[model samples]
Target: MRTTRNNNVAISCCSSSRNLVYKIKPLSHADSKRLLFKRIFGGEESCPSNLKEASTDILRKCGGLPLAINVTSSLLATRKTEQKWNEVRSRITSAEGIGSHMKHILSMSYFYLPLYLRSCLLYLTMFPEDYEVQKECLVHRWISEGFICGKDGEDLVELGDTYFYELVNRNLIEPVEVDYNGKASSCRVHDIMLDLLIDLSNGENFSSLLSNKANLARRIRRLSLMGNEDEGIIEQLDVSHARSLGVFRPTKQLPSLMKSDVLHVLDLSGCRGLENHHVRDIGRLVQLRYLNIHGTSINELPKKIGDLEYLETLYVDPGMIVLPESVSRLKRLTRLYVGTGTKLPDVIGNMENLQELRSINPFLQSTSFPEELGKLINLRKLGIHWRTSRSVGSSYKEKLVSSLCKLENFNLRTLNISFWLDEEDDFIRDFGFPRLNSVRTIRLWVGKFCWIAKCMLSHANLQDLGIMSGKIEQQDVETAGSISTLAEFGVFPACEGPVTITSRGFQQLQEFRFTWFNGLMFEAGAMPNLKELALTIPMYMLNYSESCFDFGIQHLASLATIHVQIDCRAVKAADVAALVCVLKSMAVAHPNRPALKMRTICEEDMLPDE
Candidate 1:
């Protein structure tokens, strides 16, 4: 016996002794309707009398296929009336095309969506199959493509998120990751849905997918080239009308963009064949708005890049790329992201529209660099990388702190600063961290934990805090726990020594993570509201006494999960087994023990002698 499984079909190929072949049948009509009704009404036992006839007809038209039934049900969930259901049934029965069995069912769902939603759904086809789309990236693209327009008092990012959730609610896309606040962070489309979208996109000339460049559309608006180099095919196409161009997995050098005068979004982020020469004429594409060359080989941005009057976003990978001073000419630029060591023109402060600037290496010889950064009044998110060697004199430190003080008046909400300083250097004393009202998220990678204590007291609205420091004292932990508004907190390995949490701390924290800590002692009633706890500690440091287990974890009444990673280089297998047994017993004894997940990582060979 042999079996084959395709998108909506499962077939069993078999040859009988009588020399006859037989094909397996699909789901029976009764079974299909049962599944469809369960999904449409959210597992309700029976359908209403008024909709019974409509449901039966809809299921019969779906042909007893699971994918068809689910897609049909998603569409029906929106249109509650019997008349609307009958209308959808009629359309599904009449849709014509290859693979009509599945295509028609999906097409009915697409056509029934609102006009604005249709464009948003079609835009998803540009991404590769099984790609996990980041919520921010997708929303930004939608806004750039003119698909998202906020109404009165609505922020554009919030509005875009609404559109994304709407698609998920309609069962068109699958949600991959949701944050602690129950907000989706990433999503993906089903393979069958992608196929239908590709077909519809090509048919309408709404977008083009170039694999070999055959059957090129006369006037394509959006073009996505996949697979290896096919310069011959790329050169033959007329790209003057293309508004967006993307090249994926290019094996050889890419063609120039001189002919594509009307391009708006150009993304060649991971193309290995990208070179400086290919983008020499990029300045001529004056209509460009979004450009991403993240993982390419280009070493320098042409001086003519300043010619793009309407460009809003510029993203490039980190390297020694020499950005021309003319970049300050882009008055409309909103987001500028570059590598760690990339040099910025002194006139960067002239780009008044900049909102997000990441990873500025502040080691330049110019003393006025920090002053220029202070002039970005519109900046919302700022990331700076500082090294001890750059701190030549007190003058640099004074200027840096002065610039940060000016930023406090702006609308900055997120701040990430990483420091590589010697053990003797005091981060908190040298840099007088300014207090900001709008800042809510703070991430620090410095040696001083004292600075964090000051920030916690300063930023009352702060919700997320991440600290990677050395020797976090008991007072520092107490300070973090005292923040009534904190929801998520993470302390990485750089932190040394044991930390104790007293009773009645962390009133609102839901998630807590501790890595490479010496020990953790929780007084009863500590972290009363924490839902998730993760600990990564070396096995040698754990004091597996009965009292330790008795007072440590059993007190976390609200914990739903305890994930423990134990490093087992210094302990024997028997000792590890004994520890696991004790932990299991403790969990079984607690009132609200929560689910326990533990893993052991062997750092040395511990096998018995042969």
Candidate 2:
């Protein structure tokens, strides 16, 4: 049973089966001050000057407010005779800036935050700047790995939100200006706070000490050592310092540092000097969960590499690498990622617990798909990339599809099939994926355009469908019949796809996207239900090479969002005027779907759609 308290702001769950009861209370002024002081002073030696001043300034800033000044002063004296006036003044100025910027959040009452909550908040500092920290994504990651607590007693989403807000109130995270209903669209930690977090996480006891200073030992859990010319880690490590460690990087042969008792995640991608000795050293990190040796000089993983029984994720990037025959021994691995790897060992199908297989290389040359791949019923997301077209003759493509059909009953959500299929071959036959009814998103990269219209119509539950580069012919009249019903559709132009789409079958689509279509045009009244329309390539006039083709807004009456790409050099003001005029006419006619949001991306700003 769940009980609500504090006017429905707080919830407490009492469950006899789970033996759980939990309550979270708001912070009072005194409590806020106490926590601020505790956090600031505990790591004072390592904390930046601006942070210490920010902590002290919060106290005095609150004093100017109506409610906080009346609180008892017996807790800490107002040091009237401060000898370090210079430090105090400088800190006060910086703290004042922080206080000014976060006035609304700071005024909110604090809560009794748990240590784990603080740790989780601090860990975010390790990410690069201006990251969009999806609250749900973070919560799922934590819950999956046993980092969060109290899931049995309350809604995890609400608890996660509360902790996130608390962290924000404590001035640990700053939200980007964009918000959807007060939820952060993006977030970033102030650089000062990030430095503080890095210092704390990569403590002197745990971090791989690269310098003579042993102070950075225990604090580092995940180390990302980039670049080529780094000195050997043996001279840098102070092994007496480690407490918690996760990753070591730069793909180097750092055996002295690698021999640490705590290192868990290793990324040895792009290191040129790596050899068999490094692979042997990697086998010793039994607790290792992720190992990325992509782009390294090591061509083959040591046979003993499978000894790390706990490893769950591995990325061998751009190494043109191959695995030892013993890789089938890694029965616990859930994710196996190989980028630019030449061939996969035939024994990979022997591992039954494997859940994901991804390869990102255009140069992959494995001709036949392993029959054993069908054994991986637990696999959910599969991304295979291969260049060059071989029609349906490639048994590898058949095996890939056949393997997918075997996993028809699993809870598979995403399947990316990027294979070369010819126009005449039936890619989706009866032995086709019947169990893919659960699949909500599917991406197909058929080599020929004529295969698209037929391929788009087959999937049952596909809400999002992407078709990339094949010759698109307008011959199939019934093809448009399937597209009208799609909720979302994307097409990368082929040399011979539909030249003119004048059909009424596209009435039910909510989103319709086209990319690089040299000669494609939507017929009048084609997309009535379309809410969003994205055109990746500019519409140009056939006769005038320098002029742009214009689509008047009235043609897309139901579109609420329109995104188009235009060449700045080729576009004219009259073209924009024509577009606006078309939009104005559409707005005047359809009063309900007014204010069509239009955006144009030039070549300089355009990014390839994923």
Best prediction by lDDT: 1
Tens digit per residue, CA lDDT, model 1, 1-610: 4433442223223333423334446579878877877887755476667888888777777776777777788898877788888788677664453356688788778988888888889988778888888787677667667887778745566788999998887778888865545567899998888889988887777787775243374577888777744678767777788888777675455545777788888888887677787788889998998888888887788989999998988888786456788998999888888876888888788999888888777765256778888898887788777665634666776687777768767756666666555655554544445665555666666556674466456765777777766667677778888888888888875445567777757888988888754567877888888887877756665665545544477777688776777777666777667767877786677688677788888846444423
Instruction: Count clashing pairs, candidate 2.
Output: 34
Q: Determine the C-alpha RMSD for candidate 2 after optimal superposition of all C-alphas.
A: 15.4
Off by more than 4 A, model 1: 1-77, 80-100, 151-155, 212-217, 228-231, 362-365, 386-410, 419-427, 494-503, 516-610
Task: Go through the candidates in order and give each one's C-alpha lDDT.
Answer: 0.74, 0.52
Please write out the lDDT profile of model 2 over residues 343-388, one tens digit for every residue.
Answer: 6666666777777777643334344344666777777767655444
Pairs that collide in candidate 1 are 318-339
Q: Rate residue 155 of model 2 by lDDT.
A: 44
In TM-score terms, candidate 1 sits at: 0.80
Q: Candidate 1: lDDT of 66?
A: 75
